[model samples]
Target: MNRFEYADNKFSEIEMMIAIPSFIIGVGILSLPQALASATTAMDGVFSILIAGGIVTFITWAIAKFAASFPDTTFISYASLIVSKPVAILLTFLFAIVFFSITAYQVRKIADISKQYLFDQTPVEVISLTFFLVIIYAVSGSRVGIIRLNMMFFPFILFIAIIVVIFNLNWFKFSNFLPVFQSNINDYLTGVNKSLFSFGGFGILWFYMAYVNKPNKAPKMAALGTGFPIALYALIFLACIGVYGESVTASMLYPTVELAKMVEIPGGILERFESIFFVIWIMAIFNTTAMAFDITVLAINLVFHHIPKIKIIFLLSPLIYAIAMYPQNLIEVSAFETFLNYAVFYYSIFVLVLLFVVAKIRGVKPSE
Candidate 1:
């Protein structure tokens, strides 16, 4: 089999739009509401959502524009073509480490949440390892297979998640959303800045655009991908804020899960709706972990001429597992998330700067 057999020029522009955002938005959606609540009051959460989503949308467009400037060349390839080989290699390494670390962190969070809420008796290591294995298997398939897998799972997850939200509508208190505009404008801006981390996955399009059949329209497709998540996240954020007071939502680690707990079907067929929600969430998290792992693998393959003899998935899995196992408690996990925000912020800067330098040196004009 070819080393990168999945790297086909087969995906339509709409699929590109769907697959890219679906991959990025999965895990991020779970924590975004709490992140906003902590940063500002419940009412201000709306503004935060809008500002963060808007900023992420702009950045996605910029990256898409950069990618489209060089048709048929991946970001790894174009970095070398535009900049010094050494610098390109350095950037590629940075990209790899970023994605790898993100994969580790997300896996760790999933394991932690599962142990806390679902399987109290099962060892955390076992739970996490099993989850990681499933992701590796999914990612090892062809790109088309992965895309189809995402299409199959995304709607079900969304449906379950929305049902949970809708069921909790009666619990929503307008009083919970009182004192609108009570928070300072600066507080809302800071919330927006922090919330940007929730949208970090949109950057994956940088690598994906090269393989798209209609490379010329990749920017528009990418924008569509970015928009989908923004809309979905904003709705969820509003729901969480509307249902629970700002203080209560801010205090909770995963407000979405809390929202799930509040869900009540008329028949009471399920006493614990959160458990059912967890099943769907596991699939969503698996999709994200697989996408992150696949992108990292592709970047490495592009940078190095020699494909290593070892199974790339097997080799990387243990390293990611080890990283996931590092955080001993939720405090440590929160610290790591803070570090991730800074890391992603710098990485975004790196992309923008790298593209600017490349365009200046290559005399490439901005896309028309």
Candidate 2:
């Protein structure tokens, strides 16, 4: 990752921009309403989501600007200049570990959900292995291919999400907002901390922005890309409370998917709407896993310079599988997810801020 080598597959700021939501909107959205419901009352979750989104957006913009400042250089390279090489290398390894952990978490989550909804008879291990295999194929390809995949899948994801929200209008009860803002600051703070992980994809900006054709435009476009999901999640939270009420939403596992279940086509053409939602949502999850695992590969490559990229993927595949299968039941799975949320919060927010402040104090300027 310290190498400044740029391949021919550099992308436009637009592509980089769209990749944000493509990464941010995956597995997190499926269960956010439930998490928010338990933490905040009524429509108050909307404020928590907005507040978390704002925090993520600001950090994404600033860190992207900082990463882009070094132009053509990887994050590790610039960090080594600001802090010593050994420290930068350690930081990169930790970054890679967090990404790897989240990748495993996403793999396990998809397998568990798919088994519940789509493949009741199939083993979770089988589903997770198959899913990770495809991600391996993706990571083995050109990096731009992953970004292009994000671009292709994002529109369908967003369109389906919006359709779910719009079709659920009949279920809305305006009285849901009657108890607005009833939650105290602690509730809002708790809710915001819980929801912030959904926007954690911003952490990818450090490595990804190094490939943007126009680094100067990185911050604005990154923020704009994230804006889409912030609105989408807040709206989905509102739709969940509106359609199902706060108590019911809190009781359910996947309220957003439930919203899809309630959508009836005008002509009765589309039955089992949640099926389509699951299919498209898998695409979103794929984007997340591929980008994250790719970064894991990049970070490992930085350490083992002589080893090939394909070998790294092969070496890590079994470890990810083991981690995915380690969670025996729902309670353990939830605990594992909470661990990831904290890992991501620390790396994405705290680590990025540390890098930014250190770079400034040391007066490390970007290459002209």
Candidate 3:
């Protein structure tokens, strides 16, 4: 069986950053602020954002260091070259499971949110199935096609989100953020721990670095990608806090959407502004799900030495949908969130350590 080949030289660093970060920013933008506010006091949520951003930035730098050293190898291949084959395969399987589970959890969250906010009477299975179909279609496309699709959709999503932010500015109360850092320091630390899950998708860069047309520029592009999401997340977190006092923000399930509901245009043409926000959010979610599907397809092709056929993509969809169905309630989903927090923390640390050890073993010098 022939291994699937990426079009040997396609994506520029800027394109890679655009595709990768658009995938990471989805649920994080909408849900993380509320989670942070609940874990810490609203004032401390800002501090938590700084901490989360620092941790992610440092870890991303380490991953880029490793990618720069190898230049033209995927993480799967690098694992074997650095470690023994057995260990490499074991690690790859572990990461595959992690990616699959994360994908399922995100899909499930999208389904639940859609049911509650957008389609109040729609069945969860139907909603999930519909999105699952879309993801399969996305994954079946060529790599360039997926990249083009992401670039096209991301700008519109950002524009709508910015409009939502502006329209809702009047609802913000500066007093809501007055008692910054008044909460217990432990709460702020815990909030940072929780927010790590929001930074999960950036690691996709580890796999894509191998395919980056300009390997020399990968590190800078990776940094830009990582920094962009962190900045966007911080602003969104502050917006949530400003609109909803820490107490109320902490209590709401989807505080960002709730804040959008509070948006009122001066002209009073529409009563519900949240629907507009939701449209953009749906696009964001699509980008994320497509990214996960893309990575999974790439990994499968590498492992099995065959291009992913359309049938394989179709077959995988129902499996993902099934796994997504297991989270029976919000509590179960919260458990998954907790699991994701620790998983990302440890994964980041392991990848950094492994990268350093590999670089020393390989005797790789830093790139100019």
Candidate 4:
């Protein structure tokens, strides 16, 4: 790709397939077991994960179809045609805030976990600042650089997830998952709602599909990408339940992290696995943060075309840092995350549906 091509576009179907899952499976994975356990039984959580995954996949496909309809144009561009330019600008800024909010959540959560598991003596301010620096460096380069980072690190992410599951097999009890369907309709609804929110990151496809080499293939690639996190979440949920029981998993703050703590290497190859796990897991979180940051910059650039991306990234870093540090403690962090959960969910539906309906009404044809 030449400079012009690289500047204009940065993703292919395969890169997108890798990027979507990498974006989706970040800090949320750490708390997924607790989220699922709180709403339903161990077995019920497994079912809820699958159900929620399917729903999210369909929503993402819908967003992809909307993007495909306006090939070579981003949500920010087409939305202006559907609505007024000022309205699109306002909504774009609002959505950029949402993305920034998630990046904040990731940095805060990663810092919290690092303090608890890996750096008991280190200050969270120091850890978060360091992590933020890495995120800035990742986003400073082309979006293609970030996409390649995801593609390279994805396997390590999977390896750690599978290793966590495999190493916990000795503690697994079949009876822990017994008495399935113990929860009522309300319980299932609550569990599915929580699980469904974890898949919120897929909404990035709205902004990203415009860069796809084959925009026509984006829906299928995105659908397949969605499946990775679903299967990974289900397996992790099952593993947590089998090892810790539903009650225990629900009570614990980070059940998956705890699951890593439980692994006992026979030869004492590495005494502490959770630290190793967190090291790998933090990179996955970085992928999530960088993608969110990149989109926020992209959104801003859509309105102010003269600003360079590098400068925008530098200008936004402090605001993101401030947001990440705003939460005083874990309770406040959880409250913020819950707010983001519902916000992303409803906002995504509104944006996708509005675009699709307006496109049809306006006779916006899908490109050849």
Off by over 4 Å in 1: 1-9, 308-310, 364-368
Q: What is the C-alpha lDDT profile of model 4 across 1-368, one tens digit per residue?
A: 33322554458899988888999988888888998898896678888889899999998887887787788887777888887688888888888888888888888889998998888899998999999999998787778888888999999999999998999999999899988988888888888898898888667887888888888898888889999999999999999999989899999999989999998888999878888898899889989989998888888887788999888988999999999999999899999999998988889898877767777798766555
Worst 10 residues of 4 by lDDT: 1-10
Among all candidates shown, the one with the greatest lDDT: 2
Ranking by lDDT: 2, 4, 1, 3
Clash-forming residue pairs, model 1: none
Whose lDDT is higher: candidate 2's or candidate 3's? 2
Ten-residue region with minimum lDDT total, candidate 3: 1-10
Candidates' TM-scores?
0.93, 0.96, 0.91, 0.96
As a whole number from 0 to 100, the lDDT of residue 12 in candidate 2 is: 90
Instruction: Please report how far candidate 4 places residue 151 from its true position, in Å.
Output: 0.3
How many clashing residue pairs appear in each of the predictions shown?
Answer: 0, 0, 0, 0
lDDT of 1: 0.78
Reference-based lDDT, residue 131, model 4: 94
Q: Model 1: how far is 148 from its true place, Å?
A: 2.5
| Cα-based lDDT for every prediction | 0.78, 0.89, 0.75, 0.87
Candidate 4's C-alpha runs over 4 A off are 1-8, 366-368
